[model samples]
Target chain A: MKTLKYITLFAAISTSLLFVQCKDDDDNVITQETCTDGIMNGEETGVDCGGPDCQPCGLVLDFSGTYIQEDQMGRPGINTVFGTEGFKDAFNVTVPSQMQAAFQEKFETKLLGLNPAYTSNALGLDASTFTTVLSNDVLWLAQSGVTTYFNGTEILTGRALSDDVIDVSLLLIFGGPMGDQNPGLTSDGVPTNDAAFSNSFPYLAGPF
Target chain B: MKKSKLFAVIGGIGLAVLSIFLISADHIDAPAVQGTTADITDFYAFQGQNTSNFVFIANVQGLLSPGQPTDEAVFDETVLLEFNIDYNNDLNEDLVIQAIKRGDSMYFFGPTAPAFSGEEGTKSTIATSTRRSVKISTRDDVQIAEQDGMKFFAGPREDPFFFDFNQYNAVLSGTASSFNNPGMDTFAGTNVLSVVVEFPKSMLPGGTTGVNQFAPSTPMYNVWVEAKRKQ
Candidate 1:
């Protein structure tokens, strides 16, 4: 019985190859079988169309199937700066659940290297603890409260459109206890967006 | 500033700029995605004007100067912009909102559960029953679509990220001690293609109250944005 099944499989393969050979030999001529075969062939831009015998195919946009992640940003500059040189790409695709475990040690190393002073930050997070927190890299926001990114009063409660994330990130990295260590390295001179944000829905300012 | 502190800052100028792999606020990225539409410039999650709603904004194709042809700076049809929400703090996206450009319109899918999640990416089937769309805004005029208490907009907008790239480079390379008090906004007058969505908090995993027992202390959700390309 097994031998019979194997022979049947071989016969099917041989038959398909024979058909393929015939189609290859028939180049310009569209055999009715080839046209209605439900395969893209013989000048068919799509499946068995846009060719001699078949009707022209229209553009079909299929928004389906799996996509590959090209870039991911949660907390600004986390991966760009903290992710070691060769591992930034890996960090981009790493799932947040595994980010801490996958990149925590490396993040810690980068953090200390960037600031060898090696102490707790404005958030009062020690070197190891701070890197662990940052390694997760997901932007945390609260449903309730004034939504602002790292305001002196509110911390990580969603970023407002006008939030100065760069300055905040700088302070946390260079600032020490009480958030006032390096007055210079802490805040970037550019404080706000060039244009004012809108008060209405879709609040980003219109293009220049 | 105190004289001694000023001196210290001045003295540190020569030692400040280190050759760190510094990129602006998620701009001018690594070679793989730097110039691609999949390059995510910034992700800003905030409260909407109507405090009842939460807004998620993802900006891409960063640093579009005024001189560049605006029409040429369009969203890529093959790129999928996905905002992932992790409600339970397990660091996995429990729900996602995806936006993609098709023809002249931009389609939005989900605020619903994801068909697939995590690093593997998703398909258009993830849209489920909840879907809304708007014509892609090509000019200064805003094109917005509102449906079922959700608002959607995709268009060119002033790049909201403010960074002094040159000064930052100097500081990193040990050439400058600190950033200037009024440093240049490298992104000034530039534009970014932004996808904005405003939806009621009730649409999220924990509903309007947003009290997730799993994460009682922090935000009900962990949000991150990713730009994925059709394979």
Candidate 2:
């Protein structure tokens, strides 16, 4: 019986040791797996667990809408030229020859620093007709000449020019006349235009 | 013997608990973005001069590479893209134009413009159209081509956004000292999901006239867009 008692006590002690060893190993495994709250120096390193600690991906509210005056009543504003019917089909006058040279000369001299190799050859319109085409087709520029293109087709024809502002503004907005005096390009190598240029007429909408 | 049996039970229990904990930990370590969410990179609403209608574009699936074709295939079919219109001074949705995509095609639900302002789902459908099979080309009207008497286009197209994410990231992380001379565009060669919708100016809450007499009377109307996940 004494021998039996000894055996029982030994077995109990061994089992207790095994339990303690298992507990330590379990703890070590947990420490190895989740060693840092799954965070590194307060930085999240684990998948979002749908809890307060986990940050689920979401749709960020982007409220960057730019409001422009819309045409209203019988007395629509000059800016409302596009909404008016028969605006596009109206007779499109060619730009005057003398004005083309002056405009091109001025643009080349004043804006060439913005766009290198700024030649009129690439411009779809000749010097004499460029202004009229721009005034009629371009939405952002203030209309100085006869405004006619209200139809989407004429506007669509000028979509490339309208979209080209992304490039033009890059040069002119920063280094040319409108850019910040601080000599540096935007992260994309485009010169940073002055803040005022961004606020200037016809705020070109962007996520560009 | 009883004492030994009790100790063995405790050890077994301890082991079982540890195993469960480790399993849970493994699951928590996986790094995959969740579904049922929409990431809108850009929203554009403007009057189309070429037409009497206004244009609405929702750009998604941002920062995609030309080689990442598989990721482009995962647009959720059940997700609904809705365009809300508020006609009056109240900041509520008055009209809704919803669109959904199926295998290689898109279906527009409504231009749901009512004689008076109200919720969108309840409004009547004005027109319906479907786009051609999906490809890297421009296609026209997927559904409700004309709602409140306006045209629409729903399909895939190259992302129009251009941004230099690498430079931007460097700027944020304090690794880069300054932007480049002309700047670098990380998104120069990327693509995104695009949804374009056009409507008549008359359909909007603001009258068709070019004056400031419209409700929500700011020179620039405050508008944001979203794509809600289906339940």
Candidate 3:
């Protein structure tokens, strides 16, 4: 009985010492992986900035002084086809609310310059109304309906990953009511993505 | 704990804060910002698998070669990616979803209410009252996270846009009237950095909406993505 009691006491002592040794490391166990605790813990250089949990300061582009306009894409060719180089910066920097007023005439002129025939599109939206929509520069989405850039039935009701937006835009801009006017000029030909997209959340395809 | 229920990733852009805006589509345009992190190749918005949910995607840095190693890229830390939603047909975002990348995690904030709205958006210095983050997946493995009824994912994804730029330029140059039946896929065999988010439709403010394309006063939801640098 004495021997047994001694062994049990020794085991208990050993376990307590191990716990004591690990006390400091245990503090980080709960917080090591967390980034937004508002406290700069772990290897983070700033408050929730730097280290593994957040992007390091080194990787960020240095835009310290001027916040110049970089790039903009809402509908496929709004800026590329419509906005002139002189107006590109203006169009890009212009807020959507103020876009149409500033760029509608320019957009119409560009449209007429491109097609020349200059009539209503298949959607029945004339140059003024159509340019108005494009000038706002935003992808319109429907909450409870089929999602596509344009599917003959629904127009500009959000876009799916597989929607041939370029084709639709071409048909509207170059093709007439029956969509056969500029059949040759309508499609860019390349269809579908290089790979298959995921069916679940983040629905993008795996990088090649 | 608290991080799971409430945290915000204010995707920082620009000089000190980055703001990414998606307005037009072009592979290699924008002379100043071409091939940089501000280069937004494409932006997509769609209804989620559940009709009540919505998904927003912003793809940047197009033509990252499929097999090229000299081209590894990251979501510029100095940049902030913001999705602007105009639910009232006003052409301004009433609500914004901001995404920022840190380390190997992507943080998202506010399909909440907009604290700031305009052309050059100043990222709120306030940490997202609600914070949610997901692990950044690599090429070998993918990462996803679900929290507060929203799902998030970030990292490299295959480029899904299909277009024949050669044929397109040909038509534009007046050499052709239209285009070929099956033009070559120029974007094939390439990859892009994608940040994706899916959330409840109700999260965005909308009540009076459009009945059809011809309807007036219909709440047309206008969405665009932006990359802004901190000033």
Candidate 2 deviant stretches above 4 angstroms: A1-208, B1-37, B49-51, B67-74, B113-149, B207-221
Model 3 TM-score, 2 decimals: 0.77
Q: Of the candidates numbered 1 and 3, which has the greater DockQ value? A: 1
Per-residue accuracy of model 1 over A87-182 as CA lDDT, tens digit each: 777787778878898999999877766666758877778989888878988887786767777677777777787888889888887787677876
Cα lDDT tens digits for candidate 3, A1-208 = 4345445656666667775754333333344544565555568887566886565655552222333345666777677667643476566566776788899888887676566665888887888887887877877777566778876666777789988888888888877666766666667776676677777788888888
For model 1, residues B1-231, the per-residue Cα lDDT tens digits are 343444344335324323325556787455578778888989999888898899999999987877455557989988899999988777778888999987777888887777766654433244636556787887656788887899999989888888887787676545677789988987888888999999998887562223322234555568899888877
Q: Which stretches of candidate 1 lie over 4 Å from their true place?
A: A1-61, B1-20, B119-128, B207-219
Ranking by DockQ: 1, 3, 2
Give each model's whole-structure lDDT.
0.75, 0.34, 0.68
Sort the candidates on lDDT, descending order: 1, 3, 2
lDDT of 2 by residue, A1-208 (tens): 4345445656666677875744333223223222124322123343222233323224121212221111111101111111112221111111111223323333333232222322232223333233333232112210111121122222211112023223332332233233332233322553322111122112222222
In terms of TM-score, which candidate is strongest? 1
Chain B fold agreement for model 3, TM-score: 0.80
* DockQ computed for model 2 against the true two-chain complex using alpha carbons: 0.04
Q: Which docking band does candidate 2 fall into?
A: incorrect
> What's the C-alpha lDDT at position B91 in model 2?
29
